[model samples]
Target: MARNKNRTEVKNYKKKKLTVSTSEESPAKKKKMSPKDPEDPDDALSKVESPEMKDLEDLTPEEQRKRERKLKKERKKEEKRLKRESAIDDDDEEEKPSKPSVCELSLQYLKSWSEKRKDWKFQKTRQIWLLQNMYDQEKISDDYFPILLEYLEGLKGSARDTTVKQAEDLMKEYDKSEAKAEADVQKMSRIREVLQLLS
Candidate 1:
């Protein structure tokens, strides 16, 4: 009887531990990883490894071609799913999306303009600018504007006017040891060099 009681106590203890640990996981995570279907090695391997890759493999060859054709349509949806998941993970810290002031938005839009890069040209820049203006006129709130600004700060512009403006801005604030001064000047010159290639 004592041995049986001890065995029962150990079993209960193990169950308690498992429950405690599992409680931290999500319901989606609770779903068992489905075994790789042997008939589809790619699918099986992907499932055991990367679900994203597996999902891609699950499609028939013909369906895959169709899938590629519609990638543009699906890109936004995939991005939204990732964004939602990221937002969920960031629940510990509440994030407040800041609307860019008109001046800030204009500055950002101008900064994104490229005049001569292989992929980015004046035409595309103008299109984006027009789109931005239309969005503003339509009173469409851009929650991603600030995020866009972060990327814009890193993009290389391809126009002389924009390059010169960027350099002048750098020259103006070159002296004040605010933050990342040397890096700022270097980045500005790099942008200028890229723009110079257009000429």
Candidate 2:
């Protein structure tokens, strides 16, 4: 008899606990599942229909024409705004001068002169111009001066007297500079060798 009473008490306790847990959960679930209010008419209309298309069939001819004109004006304004933005972007890009490639610089130099010269003359002139420009801009190191001179020497042709003279002058200048540099280097090395011997 005592065991039966204890079993009944345990079962009652479990039932009471379940009811308390369910009660606690009900309010939270109710908050989450609450009914939403009806959507605003303006929001619904904006989403599903544009002002231009709304009630078009019911409107008179004059009203329709006015709507059409308003749409056209808005379209023109949008187009103008886009064009203005594009112009500003182009101006920004132009303000920043990009580094020119050798071929591009050559073309620019050729375009600058009005008189037309022979092909070989033009090519030699272009090469000299490129070397000078690159040297001035510090784009080409002094070590490459000999290589550029050799390249110019290789372009020599009997086609134009003036071009050949110019190339020879440039070559002579480069050779003199290179010789001076070599002599300086040798003098420095000899001084270093003597210092080592003394040490």
* TM-scores of all predicted structures: 0.19, 0.32
- Mind giving the per-residue lDDT tens digits that candidate 2 earns over 91-192? 987877679887566655444432343332455566666544433325443444344434444443452344444445544555477555654554334333
Alpha carbon lDDT of each predicted model = 0.48, 0.48
Cα RMSD to native, each candidate? 22.5, 24.5
On residues 135-181, what C-alpha lDDT tens digit does candidate 1 reach at each position?
13133224433333343445455533464465455545654656765
Off by over 4 Å in 2: 1-40, 43-63, 79-125, 131-140, 158-160, 163-199
Model 2: colliding residue pairs: none
Model 2: per-residue Cα lDDT at residue 103: 55
Off by over 4 Å in 1: 1-122, 126-159, 181-185, 191-199
